[model samples]
Target: ADLSQKSHRYVRSEPGGPPGKDVYSLLRCRVLLGRPYLIEGNLLAPNALHDFLLCDDPTDALETVAEDWVTTGHDAFYVRGLQRSAKSERGVYNSEYIVFHAWQALPLYRVDYTLE
Candidate 1:
């Protein structure tokens, strides 16, 4: 992503997730070389920014230790994406107190763009 083009702003788009639901997310975009493009952000650990996060990847399920070995908390260090994980069956949502063992796929938000 182009650091020089990165711009943060608030926007209201059509609701597609649920009815009467207020959703919030961080959006980072850039305009480089007079061309408008979207820039992707990553979920990083405060202690390990270079390391890849499993939560950032799409999968039926994700498993991470409740306790962080390197850091003090198992927090989601997001730049502009998912804010929290449920730590239950829903994992990321508070649908059920149960933990979902069944393979449940999640949508990937990672996108990329380049200037030609």
Candidate 2:
């Protein structure tokens, strides 16, 4: 995800520094990409059942974990999409969160375009 096209602003506050030199980084787009492989086997982890499965294919992994969650009632993560701000004038921004078991899946790409 290329964030070069997004409109953004940078703020810097320094006691005795050159103008706009305090902060070097600002709002930018970050991306994460990953590849998962599919495996056919019965998952049997001693603990952390609700965690995202580490696999070649996340779709198949998710299905395997979901089926286990249904049959065993194990802990799991849920996806949540949240607005970046309740009130904004520029445009709409959004963010997503994995409430639980975020560390289970192998992270590939994380696209983050956050501004503060």
Candidate 3:
């Protein structure tokens, strides 16, 4: 499936505030007509969360995406690295590459492949 086509709503820590502080530090993402997944990672360094959020590098965000995919009954889904470009900036820039990097690291989490 073309997972990129899916639309997502960011569930910030506060109703109208940015993520991180006082928040669950969770990324709630879902696929259209598909299940929802929670991506858990450190908001601080030593982990790629910072790079995944700020840098235009996809290599930093792969593990989180893959964790969500597996936990949300989409284990079969393949998370390619973020696509980089000169104009790319922030997490959105090289999201694909960051994702690939995360996948390689393999974060801790559980997967529920069976449909509910």
Candidate 4:
């Protein structure tokens, strides 16, 4: 299964506007999904959030795409049916994709989320 397809499933947030102002100084939030994830690392050096990177390289980051829709290079569904062994294995398969990114995008709407 394409775990990436399940995109924001791991964000794990309850309904809310955000944490208190103190949270801003104590924790950093994840982009796309509003979760208070990493703590503010060493203040001695600037740009400490780099230490909380989920991936080593930004190139590893995939282009933004709909989570429910099939990935750019992958078919939505083909593993549904196992082929028959008696005859030439051939069942029916059709790929389908439903867009779910809208649900993820709305939270970050026109709101300003600056760390003030």
* Candidate topping TM-score: 2
Query: Candidate 3 lDDT, tens digit per residue, 1-116?
Result: 23332212233333433443342233233323223233332222333344333223233444343342332252222223244522223223222222222333433543222111
Superior by TM-score: candidate 1 or candidate 3: 3
lDDT of every predicted structure (CA atoms): 0.28, 0.30, 0.30, 0.25
Least accurate 10 contiguous residues by lDDT in model 4: 35-44
Give TM-scores for every candidate, taking all chains together and pairing residue i with residue i.
0.15, 0.19, 0.16, 0.17
The collision pairs in model 4 are none
Clashes of 1: 5
What RMSD value applies to candidate 1? Answer: 17.7
User: Of models 1 and 3, which has the larger lDDT?
Assistant: 3
Candidate 1 per-residue C-alpha lDDT over 4-107 given as tens digits, one digit per residue, 9 for 90 to 100: 23311223334454566644443332212211111122223232333443233221122333222333322232222222543222222211111122232233
Show model 1 residue runs off by greater than 4 Å: 1-9, 29-116
Question: Which runs in model 2 stand beyond 4 Å of their true positions?
Answer: 1-76, 80-95, 99-116
Mind giving the per-residue lDDT tens digits that candidate 2 earns over 1-116? 12333222323433444554442334332322222122222223322234454321223322133222232332333322224532233212332222233444454543333223
Model 2 Cα shift for residue 36 (angstroms): 16
Task: After the best TM-score superposition of candidate 4, give how far the Cα of residue 64 lies from its true spot, in angstroms.
Answer: 34
Question: Comparing candidate 1 with candidate 2, which one achieves the higher TM-score?
Answer: 2
Please say which candidate is ahead in TM-score: 1 or 4: 4
Quote the positional error of residue 35 for candidate 4 in Å: 5.9
Q: List the residue pairs that clash in candidate 1.
A: 60-104, 86-91, 89-98, 89-99, 89-100
